[model samples]
Target: MEILRLDSFSFRYPHTQRCALKDITLSADEGDFVLLCGASGSGKSTLLENLKPELRRNGERTGEITCLGRPLQSLSRMESACDIGFVMQNLEAQLVADTVRGELCFGLESLGFPPEVIRRRVAEMASYFGLGKLLNRSVNTLSGGEKQLVSLASVLSLSPKLLLLDEPASQLDPVAARELFSMLARINSELGITILLAEHHTEELFTLCSKAVLLHNGQVSFCGAPREAARFITQNRTLSSDAIPPQTKESGSAYVFTSLLPSAAKIFPDEPSLPLSVREGRALFKQKISGRTPPAPMPVIPPTAPPAVSVTDVYFGYGSKDTLLFHDLSLTLYEGELSAVMGANGSGKSTLLKLLCGLLKPKRGTIELFGKRGAKPTLGYLPQNPRLLFLADTVQQDLTACAENLRLLHPEERIQSLSEALGISDILSSHPYDISAGELQRAALAKVLLSSPRLLLLDEPTKALDPFAKSKLAALLRGLVQSGVTVLFASHDTEFCASYCDRCALLFDGQTAATGAPAQFFGGNVFYSTAAARIAAGFSYDSVTCGEVRNLWIK
Candidate 1:
């Protein structure tokens, strides 16, 4: 049964000239799992907002919406609120309480549930969501994954029939994202809850979703079964192709996607039953490449580039000596190199960036730039949440604000040139919050580049960007490196590092555990490796990307 529907819906936000969503028609059946796919600014978030009446934007609308066999307008506010649950892209924005138990009870309390009922529901939710251990813990202390889980569990406590997720895993690491998706899959299967999930990462989701709707510039480009949608996306590269699997793109003749890429390397488009897991992929690999002898792994030579930033015997922390994060940790970042710093949450990766940026002073250590002592070179730093840097109402205003503080290389033309360079000139008048995360990222980057820094530092720079945006960012960083700027970013995106970074360093236990080329870094580890590396194992060393593996296999 159709639980909700939209017909020829169009919307334009206040103070905006362009429509955010246009002639969008879609539906979600009871117990259906719909995957919403799109580029950064393709109207996925706007569509999800329209489904929940309370969260709808203040805009001009022209269309009809029906919910549970009734006109959406005819439903009461309470009815609309109780039937649909919306989870925003920013995890912290949705959290309202101090503790896990308090968060779970906040909604129930607001709904006027008795203390007894609220208590019963909170206990049930805590146990079911595996948040029992964290019930008494402060919500602020939890990791990105934990916070998202609490947000979902808190929303589910109300027993809403429909769940709307907006890039729920955008801020999490790969392992955390996998776990969240697995839980969502279980929720769809066991509880029969209808789900409409908007996401940029679709590799693991393709196997779990029943239907998919691809949005392009606020219009439905493709709406069909998940597998068919994969085929459609493969043929139409312009339609947010970042969500397309790496293994699928590696197929030279035809686009192919199998959850088990190790076993099924590649398959023809005509192959109907694509393997959906590692086991299935392995079985398929045995059937195809049974007796072929695999190639030997290559050795990685250490980089000999001149040092750009050098750290020596650094001992630093926030509060006291006992709280030291980096103790005698020494490392050197090379000039004209794109280096990635990676580690688990709370492993001091971000602290390292702060130390390099001069935001945090080391208690006992010396940092040198270009072999010069006590010299502070021009630098740009983008924190984990770049949005925090936004201070003005509009993108242009924010850029202008940044211009006032910049040590401009070109003093005559200020924000205009930088805005154009970042491709945000078109949305200069729009509010920063109104833009997509990817656009905001570019805007933030433009603001940072105002000073023309010789060195750049980014923390989780790709947290909310899709693959297409990531490619653009990678290219942009590469251009900066070519221009003699040293680039270093802290990230959990292993695939991106393997594909783009010149070097990768694993930060752990107050020191650099390993530092080497992408091939050597990923090829040495099993669990902390990229999907392409795992799939191409035994095929060739130094093959961290699907394209590289494909070329080697073809040879």
Candidate 2:
């Protein structure tokens, strides 16, 4: 049975000349897991909103949408609410109640379910989503990942047949994200619910999803099996090629899927089969290197230079001393270097960033700048939610306002330079609220960079960006570091931190548990490592990237 279908769907937001979604025709059969992919502003989110009538944005729309063989427009309010469940990218935006139990009950109660039925369904959902321990916990106290899980559980309590998820795991750590995907797979397989997901994090999902819908310039570019989509994408050499798995990118072979990249490295380009997961990749590697010698140990970076930002015996918390988050924590960031902080959700990564950026004060500690006494460095901070940084209607207005506030003599030139560098020149006139999440992040970063801060802090900067955009951001941050700006960012992207950052720090139990170069930092971690690192374990020492492993084996 066809669970959902769209015919020649075209939509344009109010006051916009171009269509956000142009003639998009797509469909999903019952029990299908469809992944919707595109570059920033390519209309993935807009198309998702169109699928759920209640969530659709006010726009000029022309299309025919069908759900469960009935016209979507003709479905009654109760039917729509009970059949389609939509989970947003921003978890906080969807949460309404104060506690976990309350949030789970809100949806069921709203739909006029009996009290006993609502209670039973809420308990089942909490157990299914692992929210039982947090039933009485305040929603505000939950971590980003926990909040997202709760939001998902709440939607599931309504017992919808079809689920629409928009960048659902953009805020979660790698472990949490993998768990969420696994849960989604189970839901599709056991419950027979149709799932349509719009997301940028494609690494693990490529193997999990049955089909993919690739959108570009507000149109359906390709819609097919995951493997076929990977081949087509690689052959075309589009900027979205980064969305292909790292191994697939390395092989440059349209014949193989991205999921098999790790195992592809262990074999020649002419190999008949490639492994998609680490277990298979490791088996392939064992066959290739039966008696090979392991590579020599790599040198570690020594911390000899003076620190740029230093914290000594920091003790901080939200309110009272009993609620401490950072307990006697100490850290150091060197000048002209990019450092990445990683940890489990709610491990105080964001709190550390806030303290470093002067958004909060330490209860009993000292944070010194530039290794100088009583000195404060000019700072720039980009919060996890970039929308908080925007105050104006349009991107142009926000940038212009920032420049004016900073008293730049040539504000126009600065705005143009940032606009071009961030690849957001086209959306300069668009309202900040109307742009895509990736575009908004870049816009906010541009707004912060206008002041020319020496020390920069970013919280989950790559949360919603495509792989190409992430690469661009890495290069941009490297350039900034080379230009004498020090950067400290909190991220859950292990591959990104291992590949791009100069150093990686693990924040655990209110302190810096481990800190070292990316190679050493990730090499020591067991579960927290990347796919490349896991696959290349036997052949190379401290090789945490596919490129590193490939270069050594090719010789």
Candidate 3:
């Protein structure tokens, strides 16, 4: 039975001329795991929000929406709240309670559940999601992944029949993300709940989803089975090459939507059938590389430049009474290189960046910049939450203020260039909060780059960026590195680190566990590696990115 359907749905936000979603016709059956995908600002979030009446944006909407065999707009508040559950991309925004247990009980209590019933539900959720130790922990103290899990459990505690998720794994590490997806699969398969998820990370989800929907410029571009959708996108990209913008054509693929395809699908776009899993990709790779000699491994050259930022035996924590997050952690970042600091959630990656930027002083040991202890150098720091960087109402206002405050010459010219380069020129007039997460990330980055700092520090820089935007960011960072700026960023995106960063440092047990070039770092990793690296592992090539795999095949 069809649990939900949208017929000719079109919506436009207030004060906006263009529609956010246009003529969107879609449906989801009971127990169906539907994957919704597209580039940044492609109406994915807008559509998801509209589906949940309580969270829907104030917009000019025209359409027929049916839920559980009734018009969606006519559903009572109680029916809407208990039957449909929504999880937002920003975990902090959805969580309101102080503790994990409180969060799980918030919804049930609001709905007038008895204390005994709430206790049983909360207990079940805690045990099922392994929240036993964290039940009483403060939500603010939890890591990003932990917060995400808590948010999901809180929503599930209400026992909704349908779940709407927006980039649920955007903030999680690879292993955590896989586990979250596995749990979501179980929720759909075993419990018979319907799930509609909007995400850019489709590698693991494509094979699990029963159906796929692709949106472009506020319209439904493709809707079909996951495999057929991949084939359609590949064919469309080839046939419409001339229609692609000149700027994006050089990126190899025309449409940013194609970047949402699985790595194997991207590597073999012309194949009769695209591979969606590592097992399938390895088989295809073996068949293609049969009787071919493997290429020599790339040489690893250590940087000779002086240390831009050095941390020696640093110890830090939130308070004197709190447990130390970093215990004698030491690391070095050389000048004129882009380095990535990666570790599991709550492993002090963000805390380390704060110490380098002087936002938080180390409790023990020392941090030095350019050989000087406590010397405040010109630096740029982008925190994990990009929303914190915006002070002005509009994006343009924020960026202009940043430039003027820095006393930069030709402020308008610099702003124009950066905005255009970041692909946020169109949203300059809009409020920073009004843009999509990916767009907001670029806007924050624009503000940081306007300063022209000698050293750059970023935490989770690629948190919400699409693949095309990621490529652009990689190129932009490469240009900055060539011009003598040093960069150190902490991230959970192993794929981006493997593909673009100069070095990969893994933090474990409150210290640098291993640090090396991408080939040597991710090449040795099993669960922490990229799909391309795992697929090419059979040939012993140590290729860690799709581009490397493609180049190897061409040679």
Best by the lDDT measure: 3
* Residues 1-555 of candidate 2: C-alpha lDDT, one tens digit per residue: 888999998999998899999998989999999998877788889888888889888989898888989999998898888889999988889999999999999988888899999989988998888889999999999987789888988888888889999999889998889888899999999899899998876767777899988877788878898766755655543222222333333444331223222223323222344344567666766676667778888987587757988889999888676988899999887988899999999999998998887788889999888887457678899999999988888999989988999999999998998888787898999898889999999999999899989999999998888765677688889989999899999999897898799988898889999998989888888878887778777667597876665555555
Which tens-of-lDDT digit does each residue in 453-480 have in candidate 1? 8989998888767665677678788988
Q: Which stretches of candidate 2 lie over 4 Å from their true place?
A: 238-274, 288-290
Tens digit of lDDT per residue, candidate 3, span 415-473?
Answer: 99999889999899888888899999999999999989899998888888887788889
lDDT of 3 at 291: 94
* Better TM-score candidate (2, 3): 3
Clashing residue pairs in candidate 3 are none
**Model 1 clash tally?**
3
Q: What is the C-alpha lDDT of each candidate?
A: 0.77, 0.82, 0.87
Better of 1 and 2 by TM-score: 2
Candidate scoring better on lDDT of 1 and 2: 2
- Per-residue lDDT, model 1, residue 290, is 56
Relative to the true structure, candidate 2 reaches a TM of 0.93
